[model samples]
Target chain A: MTAKISPELPERLVAAALAALERGEDVGLRALARDTGVSAMAPYRHFRDKDALLAAVAMRGFADLRDQLLAANAAPDPREALVAQGQAYLAFARARPALFRLMFAGHDGGPPPIEDNAYGVMVRRVRELAPVSLEAATLACWSAVHGMATLALDGGLSPDGSSVEHAALKMIVAGISAAKRS
Target chain B: MTAKISPELPERLVAAALAALERGEDVGLRALARDTGVSAMAPYRHFRDKDALLAAVAMRGFADLRDQLLAANAAPDPREALVAQGQAYLAFARARPALFRLMFAGHDGGPPPIEDNAYGVMVRRVRELAPVSLEAATLACWSAVHGMATLALDGGLSPDGSSVEHAALKMIVAGISAAKRS
Candidate 1:
C-alpha cells in the first residue's frame, strides 16, 4: 500500500490548494487531502504542517509571477521593459488576488525570500536604470508597483482602465533616472 | 426600558471592537457585546450587523490616520512636508496593522470614499507640486507611499531604518516633477 502511493501526491495537493484559493475557500491540509481524494494523513507526508503546504503554494505563485515578469521584460528599451513588468505585476494581482495575498502574507515577520524570484527580475532592470543608487531605486520601483497592485486589489484605485497605472509606473522610472543623474 | 439604555452604548461598543482588533481578536458583534458587558441583542439596536459595527471602527481608523497625515503635513518645505506625510502613513500602518488592513478591506467595490479622508490630504500636497498632470501625479504619489506602508507591514521591506522609504518618496516626487518639465 505504501509503494502504491503516487510520487506526484505533493504536486496534486498544491494544485488542489491553488484551486481552493481560487474559489475563495480556506485551504487546509485536511481539506486539500479530501479535495485530492487522499487519506487525511497522506498530506502530512509531504508537508510538515499547513504553513509548509501554504508556503509551497506561495512558492508556486512566485514562480508563476516570475514567469509573467520575465515575459513582460522583453521590451527593447529598458524603461519600457520595467513598465511592462509593473503592469504584469498588477495584472497578476488582479487575476489571482487570493494567491497574491497569500504570497505576501509574511510568515515569520517577513515575506518569503525574493532574491531568486520576481524581485530579482525587477531589480536587475532597475539596476540598469539607476546604477548609482541601485538599492533605493529598486526599492522605490518595487514599492510603487507593489502598492498599485495592492490598491487595485482593495479597489482603492479608480476603475478608469490602466492609464493611471501606466502613468504611475512611468513616473517612478523617470524619477529614479532623474535622481541618479542629479 | 428604552429610556434606561445608555446613550453612549454605541460608542462603548465601537471602543470594545477596536480593543478586540488591537488584541488580534476577530471582531464579531456578539463578542464585542460580551466584551462590553451588554446584552447580545443590545448591539443590534446600534449596529445592523457586524459589518456595520466594523465599518464604524474602520471609519475611526481613517479619521485617526487623517489626523496623523495632517500633523505630518506641517513641514515648511513642500517637498519635506510630503515626505513627512509619507512617513506618517507608514507609521500609522505599522502601529495599527489590524486596523489598517480592516480600513482598506473594501466593501461594495471600493474603499470608503477618500476625498474626505487621508487621501484628500495627500492629494492636496501632490497638487501643489505637480499641477500639470494632477491626476497621474497624485496616483503615483499615493501608490508609492501606500505601497511602502503595506510592504513594511507584510515584511516585504527591509528593516533598515527609513532611508529606503525616504528615498523612494523623494524619487516619486522628483519623478512627477521631471515628467511635468518634460
Candidate 2:
C-alpha cells in the first residue's frame, strides 16, 4: 500500500485552514496544502473546490462551538450556564472573526441543514432553558445574542469599550424572562 | 431649462435606488439613473462615486427610521411605545430588506458616522425610557433586535412560521425590564 496513513487528510486540511485564518492571511487551498506539509494536490483530493474547503472549515467551527456550549451546559447553576453559553458565543466570534463569519456566511448553494450541526447544540440548550416550545421567545433570545456578535465584529457596538458580553447577556436574560412573562 | 423642477436630483436618485433594491436588481449608478428616468450622468453630478451614492441611500434609510421611531416615541403609554417602536423596526426590515441591508452593509472605507442618524434616534428613545446611561444595556437591546432580523432574513429563525415579532418583542420587553432591575 501507500508509504503510511496519517490522520484524516480532510481534517488536517481544515486545521490548516483555521491556522491560516488565525494568521490573518489569505487561505487559498495552495497555502493550506503547504501549511499541512502536503503536496499542493493533497487538498484537492479531499475537497471538490474552495467551496468544499470552506464548508469543511465551517464544520470544525460547529464542533468547537458544540464543545463550548456543552461545557457551559455542564455548569451546576442554570442561569450561569446560559450566560456562559452566550459568553462562549461572543468569545468565539471575537477570537476568530474569520471562522465566525464563515460559520454563518451564506453560500451560493445555500447553507447545509443545521439540524445536526452546532445549531443542534443551541436548539437543545434553548429547549432545556425554555421547557415549553416558546419558539418566538427562543428566536428572540437567539437574535439578541447574534446581534451583539455581529455588532462587535462590524464596529456597531459603541467603542466606549465596556464589557460587550455582559451587556449582551443582560439583554438575552431580559428577552427570555420577558417571553416567559407574556 | 429642465422640463419640470422635480424633487431634487439626489433625492430622486436615492428614491430610484430604493426602487431598484426592491426589485432585487443590481444597483449601479447607471441602473439607478435609467430607473429614475434621468440622464446617466445626472446621478454622478450628485454623488462622488458608488460609495457616495450608497452613503446617501443609507442616510435616507436613517431618516425614514428616525421618523418611524419618533412616531413610536409619541405613543401615550411608555411600554406600549417601546414595543411599538420595536415592531416598527421589524416592519421596516421586512418591508424594505434591501434598504435595511444597505444601511448596515460594510464598506471598505468605513461606514459614515451615526451622528443624527437612525442610531441617534434609537439612542434618544432608549435614553428617554432608561433615564440613565447604561450603555451596555442599550447595546444588548440593539444586538438582540438586529440578530432577530438577520436570522429571519437568513432563514435561521427556525422554520416554525410563527409571528417572529411577537417572539422578538417579548424578549425585548424582558431585557428592558431586567436592565431597570439592575
Q: Which residue pairs collide, candidate 1?
A: none
For candidate 1, give the DockQ. 0.55
Interface RMSD for each predicted structure = 2.4, 2.8
Tell me the DockQ of each model, to 2 decimals. 0.55, 0.44
DockQ of candidate 2 relative to the true structure = 0.44
Q: Whole-model Cα lDDT per candidate?
A: 0.81, 0.68
Docking class of 1: medium
lDDT by residue for model 2 over B128-153, one digit each (tens)? Answer: 65655357656766776677666666
Q: Considering every candidate listed, which one attains the maximal TM-score?
A: 1
Q: Write the per-residue lDDT of candidate 1 for residues B36-63, one digit (tens) a residue.
A: 8777888788777777777788888889
Worst 10 residues of 1 chain A by lDDT: A107-116
lDDT, residue A95, candidate 2: 80
